[model samples]
Target: MKRMFTLLALVWAGSSMGADWQVTQSDSISAYVLCHQGDCPVRTAKVFDLPVAVPMPARVSDSAAKPVTMHSSTSVRFALASARLSQTEKAKLKAFLKRHRDARRFLVVGSTDQIGKKRFNETLAYKRGMAVAVFMRANGIPNRNIKVDSRCCIEHPPSTNPDARRAVISINE
Candidate 1:
């Protein structure tokens, strides 16, 4: 008989609290008061001291906005004070051009060591660049797509290394 009275008291206490209140769990917590019957005052009641979660907008990728650019270079050595291409160097240039035939643009840059006069080195570099450009054009590269440039001892200076004076064929896409 005593247990029955305790059970009845617990049931009464639960019934006094509104059944319309619901708790939902997500990334954050939310409480909602829903009224199945019309015009329940609990539906409009303000909830205090509970955090509400605001949903964030979805993110978008921007990979398409930037284009992919690829670059490659091959060094072709030339004789001192001359812009002539050796047979081995010509073969190397041919192979390099064939490998990068599909590139969008080609930049043939020539550089010389700081041994000769500055003006002469500049002319030498330009000739070397032109020679590589001509070869590329003959092979298959479009005339408009190829750009010839000469650094002319500005970057690489005279050293024991013969490779300091050379034509650099660069392909870019």
Candidate 2:
């Protein structure tokens, strides 16, 4: 009879406090405990983003690639003393224009090393900047929407930075 009374007391204690509250607790605690040795697979969740406002193309083409979302600033590099765009740089510029088709304006600022004659460096910078501008025109941007800035050349001390012979492209959306 004494043992039965003790068992009854225990049951009453549990009934008054915490039998159901624990069942509703998160399973993440147990999952976390299972990862003590870092072998457990982590759970993942999918994310959804808001939609974009891309306009319809003026011409329908079956061969045109889909447009991807990309950055607002990019730099296309050139060889030393050269104003020409390499095939890789051409691809980069093409992809950039594709991604930012709705941009209002584009700025191409050309830069060159300070080791050349001031007039020659400025001329090379202008040619580099204009090359990018011309590419933009070919890709459908109007001449009014593109501005080439060549004043960025030979103004600063020369450095080994690879971007010294590059055209920086910035977009105004």
Candidate 3:
């Protein structure tokens, strides 16, 4: 019995590269003998010292963990050659903005009809786009989130008779 216990302790310590051992063998009054050198009768340590390895979990990036954003657009038409917002147009734009309160960006694009001088039409389109930008600012949208693109005498959505005067507002969340 004594030889068996000693042999087992030697094998366990050798396999583990000098690891501590604790003998749980039976005796007349059973007890344990814990030591560093694996010697039951001559103990040099009372505490067990052993190395254990645990694997870490994989990591995820911000783009991978986050949901993809999709863009949505709304078109608000202006009266011929006018940069002013009518009451009904304002109401419709307000409702659209309310539905997109969490939007990350607001791209306001103003387009003009082809019946005017190139420079005059460009300025008018800019004013129309700025009008939409100002309305967005008043409705709690920040200045940094708003961008204006003024297009004059040019067809944004190509058409055969492209004289449409409108502001297209696109939001991306």
lDDT of each: 0.77, 0.77, 0.81
Better model by TM-score: candidate 1 vs candidate 2: 1
Every model: Cα RMSD to truth: 15.8, 15.1, 19.6
Q: Candidate 3 residues 1-173, lDDT tens each?
A: 99789878777766587655465655665544446554545546667687786777876567647676868888787887799999988999999988888998989999887867889889999999999999999999999999999888874433453436888999856
Candidate 2 has an lDDT of: 0.77
Query: Candidate 2 at 67: error in angstroms?
Result: 21
lDDT of 1 by residue, 112-144 (tens): 887778899889989998988888888888999
- Number of the predicted model whose lDDT against the real structure is largest: 3
Which 10-residue span in candidate 2 carries the lowest summed lDDT? 29-38
TM-score of 3: 0.58
Give lDDT: candidate 3, residue 160: 54
Better of 1 and 3 by lDDT: 3
lDDT of 2 by residue, 42-138 (tens): 5457588969979987976666676654448998988888989999999999998898888888989988877678899889988999999988899
